[model samples]
Target: MADELAFKRWKSLEPGIRKKLESNVFCRKCGVTTIVDYEVEYTNSQFTLKGSCQKCHGPVARVVD
Candidate 1:
């Protein structure tokens, strides 16, 4: 993502939305909550949160509004 948009979107995301997303993500394989490692903020097409399971280190993703 471009730096400008990235910065702008980061600021635009409400704290409640961010926290909801952070708590909602889970590892599909592990079936457990994950720690968000990176996020691809809202764009035209892709919106994702990437992280690893706190217990298993399995990769996980969740779509965010």
Candidate 2:
């Protein structure tokens, strides 16, 4: 896990990169675009995302650091 403050900094990245990450990212189980938030965890080894889909209303992806 990474420091919360550092994770906040990662969240402040440029919008273009953020969008690219969001699009390329997906749910671990569903393999869908359910990620609402994205961040590097454990020194960039893993990406944690938060948020759920508006259509399915299922378990939304959320940053889990």
Candidate 3:
């Protein structure tokens, strides 16, 4: 919930694209893991997803340009 506009933009993406983004987050503790309970943030004309790792529930983030 960091940025409502960013969240809405993320929601506007196709389901397949969104799934791809969500499932490929790199978690330092868990390697590549699906992201869950994420929030969207927009900065520097890019989208960043901050969330938890699906496997170990550790913090995870991914930047989408």
Candidate 4:
């Protein structure tokens, strides 16, 4: 689930940038993998994406400034 403000900010980004961010997540089990089923969160003045890896269906997260 994404908070309202965070989701809004995420939606404001260009599609290409969003694609880059969603496709470039680090997963220990699978190295670099695309993120799926993600949620946007705003905390400590930063945006964090919490989701699962597309390859292995494992938990993954990416922090965006």
Per-residue accuracy of model 4 over 1-65 as CA lDDT, tens digit each: 34988989888999999999999999999999999999999888788999999999999999998
Pairs that collide, model 3: none
Query: CA lDDT of each candidate?
Result: 0.65, 0.53, 0.92, 0.93
- Give residue 28's error in model 4 in angstroms: 0.8
Q: Estimate TM-scores for all models.
A: 0.61, 0.45, 0.91, 0.90
How would you encode candidate 1's per-residue C-alpha lDDT over 1-65 as one tens digit per residue?
77457546765778887776666677766664745566455566546666666667777777665
Off by over 4 Å in 4: none
Kindly report which residue pairs in candidate 1 clash with one another: none
Stretch of 10 with least lDDT, candidate 2:
34-43
Error of 1 at 54 (Å): 2.6
Compared with the true structure, what per-residue lDDT tens digits does model 3 show for residues 1-65? 35988899889999999999999999998888999999999888788999999999989999999
Best by lDDT: 4
Ranking by lDDT: 4, 3, 1, 2
Candidate 1 backbone overlaps, count: 0
RMSD (Å) of each candidate, 1 decimal: 2.7, 4.7, 1.7, 1.9
Name the candidate that leads on TM-score.
3
CA deviation > 4 Å runs, candidate 3? none
